[model samples]
Target chain A: MLLLITRTFKESIRSILRNGWLSVSTISILVMSLYIISVFFVFTSTANEMLKEIKNKANISVYFKADAEEGVILAAKTEVEKMNEVKSVEYISKEVALENFKRTNANEPVILESLKEIGGNPLLAALVVRANNPTDYQTIDENITKATFSEEVSRVNYNKNKELINKLNSVIETIQKIGISLGLLFAAISLLITFNAVRITIYTHKQEIEIMRLVGASNMFIRLPFIFEGIIYGIVSSVVSVLLLFISLKFIASYVSLTIPTVSLMNFYLANFGTILGYQILLGSFFGVIGGLMAMRKYLKV
Target chain B: MINEENIQEEKNKIMIKFDNVSKTYKGDFMALEEINLDIAEGEFISVVGQSGSGKSTLLKLIYAEEAATVGEVYFDGNPLSVVRKKNLSAHRREIGTVFQDFKLLPRKTVYENVAYALEVSGAPDEEIAENVPQILDIVGLTTKAKKYPHQLSGGEQQKVAIARALVHTPMIIVADEPTGNLDPIASLEIVRLLIRINELGTTVVLASHDKDIVDKANKRVLVLENGRIIADYPQGKYKIS
Candidate 1:
């Protein structure tokens, strides 16, 4: 068995080296596709990270009516924090709200003067409620508005930003959908091209395969060399593509930072290098092996 | 009455048998028709015919490359039809095949080409090491073992193929127009080599259209025409009109 394996391995290596240009072209296609896939992975993950940050900022501010007691507002905060959908709730006293207004309008002298004219902390104490997910905000809002202390509440501010947040959520979903579709489309095209490349290689070796069959080589013995070729193509292409992807990320990272400063593509790829390498190898092998098997099926009849 | 034990004894003596074998291809074209023949162990037979006369088809049947469409082909006391597809390789290893195209792997050296047969059979390193050089020496190709197919003459390449065929020490050697690509002198040399191998106790089935080679073979000859055997002569001289 060891001898068979050794001989099969040697035979496959000879075939790959013998068909020099064919091997190059096939590996080149694999490398290009894997690079595209890795690039897509980096960009999509960056986009998702940005969207998550945006979603984290989506929260509802619930203001208590003037003359509402501080104890009541604190109670409301504690109650909101206990809700299943609410991640956290912060209690802002009337004095803090007044201070915040003053600090925010400091750039506008006119607004600061108006705030001084009204004086004596006319602002309402509030509970800022954050939900676990963007979609959970609506439920949290409805529960708070219908609570027993509904009479003490001035208003729930979630309805004002509902449209904007919903729109953002939909946009995130749309980008995800399109990213997945395009990724699959690209993968399919790559597989088809690789399949044809392997088919061409097999066509060139058609006579040799026929001779192998004629000489009483077992079907496994004959088929194994092509399988090994596929695996070799996969491993080699994946390594090359990883290197190319790294170079590309390094080349484009600074420019991408200029336009979209939040994302560092190179850092993102390097941070997940092992995972990305694993994925590239898996995809390359999928393309190489499945393509080779499908292409050589007709010729392996003997 | 022919008893079962007596029939088994008879089958063991014959290396190959065709019982009412008929082969038809697509479009209802008959390639071999109602063929009945038996070849004993260590016999050398020449199957001579023009193109499309079922000579190749007959050789194909012997090697189990193609099955008899309407009858049975027995190789060494076992029906080829009963051989499972997975076991076909094992069956073929017992019968080495040589093609007119030589079918030598272009990238492989003459030594590698011969050793490939043993390699495919998963022969041990010691056995391959021992047998390949011995077979090359027998084929007079020991000096040219390092040369690739393109570097060798037509005769030398065929000799390598024969060396490959002999590496298995197979019971039967099936050559289909093996000298088709060779010059007259090369063809004669190939015939002479096949004869020498036959003398070493291997059954040889040579399919050829060349009259001079067939006449020189001077062995049992079966002349085929349009998928039927037109003449069968013991010690035939290729006397086809």
Candidate 2:
């Protein structure tokens, strides 16, 4: 068994060396496919991170009626906090609201003078509520509207930003759908090309395969060499693609960071390096072996 | 009485038996018809015929490369078709095959080509290392073992084919017009080698259309005509006239 494996391995390598052009072309196709897949992986992962950041920052600020009691406003905060969708709630007291307003307009002397002339603070206490997910904001808004303290609330701010939030979510979802479909289309095209390439390779060796069969070689003994050749193709292409991906990621990391600081492609790749490598190797080899097996099907009928 | 005769025949250690064998292709074209023959152990037989005379088909049936369309082919008393698909190789290992075109892997050297036969059959590394050179020596290709098929003469390539066929020490060697690609001199050389291999106790089955070589062989000859044996001569000469 050991000798058989060694011989198969030797023959596989010899075949690859013998057919240098075919091996190169096949490996190039594999690398291109794997590179495209890895790129899409990085794109989707980065997009996902950006979406999460945007969702985490999304919130609604609900102000109380200017004449409402402070205790009632505090009660609204507690009530909103109790809701399942609400991630957190922070209360801005009347004093803090006035202070925030003044600090925000500190550079505007005219606004400061107007604020002093107005004498009493015109701000209202409000509760800022954040939801666990962007989609949950609508539910939280509906719940707040029907709450016992709804009358005391001057306005629910979620309705004002609802369209913007919905538009962002929809756009992200559309991008994700298009990304997946395009990725699959690219993969299918590459796999088909690789399959045909392997078929041609086998076609060139049709005589060799026939001779092997004539020499009383078992089906598996004949098959193993081709299978090993395919695996070598996969491994070689995967290593090249991964190394290329890593180098390109490193080269573009700083530029990407400058433009889209919310998500770092390099960091994502580095953090999941093992997983990325494993995925590429597995996918690459699967495609290679499947292509080889498809080609071998017709010829092994001997 | 026929059954009794068959029992006695089986007792004589017949290596191959064809009983009313017929092969039809695509439902209409008959490749072989009602063929019956018996080959004993260590016999050298020549099958001579024109093209499409079912000579190749007969050789194929013996190794179960092609099944008899309507009857039985028995190798060492076991029906060829009854052998499971997985066990076909084991059966073939006992029978080496040589083809007209030589069928040597162009990329592999002569030594590698011969070694490949043993390699595929899972021979030990040491055995292959020891036996390949010995076989090459027997085929008179020891000096040319390092050369590729394209580098060797037609005769040398056929010698390599014979060496590959001999490496497994098969009980029977089947050659299908093995000298078809060779010159007259090379063809004669191959015939002599086959005769020598037969002398060493291996059953040799040579299929050929070359009248000079076949007539010179002077062995048991089965002349096939349109998938039927026209004559079986104990020591035949090619009678083209």
Give the C-alpha lDDT of model 2. 0.86
What are the chain A TM-scores for all the models, listed individually? 0.79, 0.81
Q: Estimate each model's TM-score.
A: 0.85, 0.86
lDDT of 2 by residue, B123-240 (tens): 8889999999999999999999899999999999999999999998999999999999899999999999999999999999999999989987889899999999999988888764
| Least well predicted 10-residue stretch by lDDT in candidate 2 chain A | A159-168
Worst 10 residues of 1 chain B by lDDT: B83-92
Worst 10 residues of 1 chain A by lDDT: A159-168
**DockQ numbers for every candidate?**
0.61, 0.65
Off by over 4 Å in 2: A65-78, A81-125, A159-164, B1-11, B150-152, B183-186, B239-241
Candidates in order have lDDT scores of 0.85, 0.86
In candidate 2, position B41 carries an lDDT of 88
For every candidate structure, what is the RMSD over all alpha carbons to the true structure, in angstroms?
4.1, 3.7
lDDT of 1 by residue, A165-237 (tens): 6675676677667767766776777667667766776777788777777777888788887777887888889
